[model samples]
Target: MRPPAQNPPTPQTPDPATAAGAPEPRTSPDTPDAHEPPDGEEAQVIVVGAGPAGASTAVHLARAGVDVLLLEKSRFPRDKVCGDGLTPRGVHQLLRMGVDIDGPGWMRSRGMRWVCAGRQVTIDWPDLGRYPDFGLTRSRHDFDDILARHAEASGARLRLGVKATGPVTDRAGRITGVTATGPDGRPVTYRAPLVVAAEGASARTAIAMGLERDPRRALATAARRYYRSPELSKDEYLELWADLRCARTGRDLPGYGWIFPLGDGRVNVGLGALPHRDHGTIDLRATLDQWLARLPRHWGLNEQNADSPLRSAALPMGFNRHPQYSRGLLLVGDSAGMISPWSGEGIAQAMEAAEVAAEAVVLALTRPDGPRRDQALQRYPAEIRRRWGRYYRLGNTAGDLVFSRFGYRPILNGQVMSRPGLLASLARLLTHLMEDPPRDTADHVLNTLVKAVPLRGR
Candidate 1:
């Protein structure tokens, strides 16, 4: 099982909350044009919402000598609901971004420990030449702040406390800039030849730009809180419990719970549930209580030990929002719904998507503003599809055919847990870590399975 997005107070935080925006109703004629805005600020690239996607995009672009503007609605060190665990995939991106992971407040993790049906198995993160061997955990509060600062240090112009309200489009209905609310409560517009919506899941700007979440995709809810668990605070493995059940109905639910150590006198404990058929209406809070009640008593997780309020948020998974690049605006991170449906992992996906978006945006900006530029921009989504589309398609298919009905129960059974090698292989597949060239039986099987799964709407 994938690590749940973590507690609010741990040093390792999950991805920040989805950006704030409502579903678009309709475009207003009063919208600002791309070329004409009173007192408009300008940049070659304007990125809205400086979380992982926005900040990572800025870091990559600015390092490439492109002018970039990164805007954020909140100040540094603010809290965001997240699971604080970072798999090796995420660690790879943080290294690419030049984040100093060896520094303080970064707790390293070796692998995952799965608990289900009175059976438990621990698997270490696979060692590969392409990625790090270990994972990390840092609360979203500090995690986002670090990325924003890294972007700024890399030469991205950061404007904090600025919330982008909508995209500024030309008469052709092509986005050319963003209109945002300034820190001083003034309306402002920032123009650019290209714009990136790196904001999280709200997807308001995407909707305003005529994109919408595909109803066919999956959406899940994650709730987390930090508890002062001295015994588990420095544990090396992220623990996932697949034995979740509905407290009232006494029926096993198709979901998982997690306890990730923060190494700072606390552990980020959380649970996430995909959309289920029969148990869709389970009370998450009550379910959490029930799950916690069953853990080892020595861990000392109790109401008084809770360090932060238990908060829940939505994770838009499996590319629910599509057409990642449209009308001069490129959707990055949660804005494009890049979270993995299988593991509920978004940090690695978001940062990685930021890298992909940066590559496309850099190339698109090099070409003249015309069909060629549009074509270059279009490669953003196409390349993303080429890289992870098949895996995600397989995940969504499994979600529809299996998880929606059984949740993690089937996978967490005694048979699957009895074989450690199989469990390790499953982890590799779930996290998209299998070798690309099919070096082993597991790799070949996973690759074939992915290839056989039809792409959605194919």
Candidate 2:
């Protein structure tokens, strides 16, 4: 669906009559008025972190005329450790945000080329008519900056170099605001009615809220570098190299190395594996070197065009299984452990979740007072779980099967390779069968199945 217009009229403020028993608003040292009454005061939604999830939430909320306070620990144009790959779904989200991603300095992809067991398979993306099927690849340094700018332009107040230290609560234990450290190292507090936590991986907010962490699987280390390679084509097809026998551990780490070609004679290459199989055992830099060395002779990566320093980070794979939403707070992006279990992809999921959360927040603040206010907040978690729970569970299952070298090969060689249709079916199931804004029936079924499945040893 297309994004709504920029900044719709503010929803009716919460009725003062209904909020009579609510605690008086406490102004913070950083705000204009700290001791004003909360009733009739504009409801401000605070979004922590300026990554995809936070930016999208701020943009959507601001567009809905909700006063949004976006806080980021880092400055703009900063680099985030990522594969720099954006799927079609991600591009769609950006488009909805009113950002034009198809310009110079971006690499557009048409589809994917899979190289496994010495066999090659190519899958074409589903057609979107005039719109390209796949996505664009750009460094997060530039990508996140663009999104932050868009959010600011849409009227969201962005506070960079501000880190949320902890939550502010009332006597009732409901969160009322956040305490943060400003760039100058001074402690500052931002008071808001609701907080959206989008902090990546290490979710400080989630922890402060007493939510326990339960990650399903951990990905092996990954390293990436960009090289100046003119021989690489810019058609948007991602290349994956899978060599089962060449792994350091005999368990056959079911991971593949990727070389994504950016249009400007530069290619992004990286490799990932399961945690127990190859963590700290292999020299990822040397492994990338070996892979790069072999690429010139066989694949398209020529030695003459390599440029840029190698980068590396650990990817959080599988479902984090953490409750994504709670009273007075909601989590998105990597903070909520939304990364894909099979592919370790999170940008699309993050953006999608941000939109859903923004909508829920709007509803929660605008509805006529009563138990519905609490119900509105409940909708965000319920909707998110309903939509993504099944796909993530399936991804966890797929990760287990693929990471086990012995198990993955046969599946890759026989089922995935021979049939092609099997992989296609899986892809379709993930994209279509699972719900987005999921129905109650589907949610119940998925919740039951995910809990029923055992996490360890198959």
Each candidate: what lDDT?
0.82, 0.67
TM per candidate comes to: 0.92, 0.79
Error of 1 at 202 (Å): 1.2
Off by over 4 Å in 2: 1-43, 128-132, 233-235, 244-247, 276-283, 297-306, 368-371, 404-408, 418-423, 426-458
lDDT of 2: 0.67
Over 1-458, each residue of candidate 1 has an lDDT whose tens digit, in order, gives 11112111112111111122323323443343464335456788889988888999999999988888898889997898899889999999999988999999999999999988789899999887788889999999899999999999999889998888877665445666777888887888777767898779787778777678888775788899999998899999999988777779777665688999999989999988786654557677888998889878889888989999999988888888877876677899899989898888998999999999999988877776677787788788889998898898888877776666667878768988999999988889878887778767888888888888765551
Over the stretch 1-458, how does candidate 2's per-residue lDDT look in tens digits? 21222212223334221243432223222223454322211236889999999999999999998888899999999988777887677888888888877667888887666677667676655554333477788878888999999999998989899888876654334556677887777777666667898887767876776554564465545678777666674646877666633345444445667778877767787776654443336566666676677655634554555566777776654546355655467888888777776566788888989999999988887863335765787777778766665556666666666553432355457447666656544433433333333344444454455556544421
- Identify the candidate with maximal lDDT: 1
